[model samples]
Target: MNLRFGLPQPLLSFTLLLVWLMLAGASAGNVVLGLVLAWLLPLFTQGFWPDNPAIHKPWKLVWYVLKVIVDIVVASITVARLVLSFRREPNSAFICYPLTLEHPLGITMLASTISLTPGTVSADISDDYKMLLIHALDVTDDEALMADIHKRYEKPLLELFS
Candidate 1:
């Protein structure tokens, strides 16, 4: 038995524990079961993952998560307002956003973040991974939307996964 088998992937284990606890309701039994599963699942399945991306700056991830949460909240309110106002149709548009970050995980995080926020959904990504398609409920300025995504989401992910 390898010594590292006890904790092959710390982040995955933590996420699995939290998810298990959330779904199973955090009783003592559930906690113990969650811990067991968290430890064992990663150890057993570690071979399937070809590459595990390293976090260059783990602290930045916290800030990035907080920022996304705030954006979700603000977007929820904006979307609610738009929905309530029946007279004006939302300036809906599909945007082709060119991606800059080279890492697949970083691109995935960026797409997930965009989808999590209200009024915007990541529709698709190009085959070459050069562009992402986004559908927005309201998009008055294409350049501004692209720039905002690049600045708020992509930049941090690039730094985090670098």
Candidate 2:
């Protein structure tokens, strides 16, 4: 059979089913309904499906997610401490860091990961995709911050997406 959709139908169906079950709170009836919807919805929208690039290493993706969670927690605590300490810390400043990963998906993931963490926000990405401008809540060492972000988040993302 010449499937017009270039992606694997089974994987797409399974992903949709899982999403539906989670959204519906995993009730037995919802599970069955989700399965039906998952199958039918993909079949109906097959023409609209886009090609997904193959993931080279699934384990790296899992590790990246875990690291993000850990970073979020640690950053939250650190930010909270700074807020409560009543010290006259300097107002945050924007810092631009050079980036090497040119993949669009990798850049998007990097931006999201940085914004999701406490005390740091992704302000903008340069048009050329060569630099990422970030705002830090506490403007301490800019070099250290950039290095930490690259090492903790960007490097792992490179592994997963690039």
Candidate 3:
């Protein structure tokens, strides 16, 4: 690891400082506090990050984010419609989704994507990290849900992190 100005993770520190500034505004106190926190956080957490996550296809990340955003919007409408309707009940069910992506970061991204979509939450991951437990608000077709997730989210993540 290259240490610049006594900082182990310069990029992370810079990102943290930028986020702090954006959230707290550009006051003198905020600037000083943000700088201190940014510098200190990387130092404190350096040991926890065993390895830095690598992005094999940075372009895919942009596309993947866009897809997720679209899914979020669509799912939000579906969930809202289900909630407002009184005639039909949501067929809520727990799904044990089999995992294909092996990388921890990839699996984490997949889990996050599932949770980010409305009407679905990633409940837990198996100890061996081979399967994921997901809960959906409504499910007409279980197999279809799993397939869609695999094709849309997991496949891209697998490719991205490979």
Candidate 4:
């Protein structure tokens, strides 16, 4: 008996199942359908994935998520204040942030994190995947911005996905 049976992307499969259950409710029929789709979708899409991403520390991932939520709230308030500020116009500029993490999934997460935060949008990534271009609504000091992103976001992602 060959007992090798498991989802290729177990985390993704479980997450999709969870989402489906949430959206479709926890009835038996819904549960059955969600589980089936969750299992089958990963199998069907396995070919599209280049490399499987592994999260080394689940605890750190939880912490990273909490930090991202807090940053989003803080950024929203900051952007709101800037919009209402009569003192001065925002110092908006495009910044090229150098990348230390090489994984595609890691870079993608970083880009998404930047875009999700208010007042900052991830504009582009370099061809060599060495830099990320970001458009900030109001950034007076570039070094400080880069430092915050590297420490708060990039570092944790590197830890998680590497």
Best by TM-score: 3
lDDT value for candidate 4? 0.92
Winner by lDDT between candidate 3 and candidate 2: 3
Stretches of candidate 3 exceeding 4 Å from the true structure: 2-6, 19-37
Clashing pairs in 4: none
Better of 1 and 3 by TM-score: 3
Residues 47-80, candidate 3: write the lDDT tens digits.
8875767888999999999999999999999999
| TM-scores of all candidate predictions against the true structure | 0.79, 0.73, 0.86, 0.80
The CA lDDT at 33 in model 1 is 98
TM-score of 4: 0.80
lDDT of each: 0.93, 0.84, 0.94, 0.92
Q: Per-residue lDDT for 1-162 in model 2, tens only?
A: 235443337777889988888888898899989988877887788777655545678899888999899989998998889998886775698999899787777888899999999988999999999999999998778999999989988888777665
Ranking 1 against 2 by lDDT, winner: 1
State how far residue 112 of model 4 sits from its true place (Å). 0.9
After superposition, the stretches of candidate 4 with alpha carbons farther than 4 Å from their true spots are: 1-6, 10-39
Backbone steric clashes in candidate 3, count: 0
lDDT of 4 by residue, 1-162 (tens): 111266877777889999999999999999999999988998888888777667888799899999999999999999999999899999999999999999898999899999999999999999999999999999999999999999999999999986
Error of 2 at 133 (Å): 1.6
TM-score of 1: 0.79
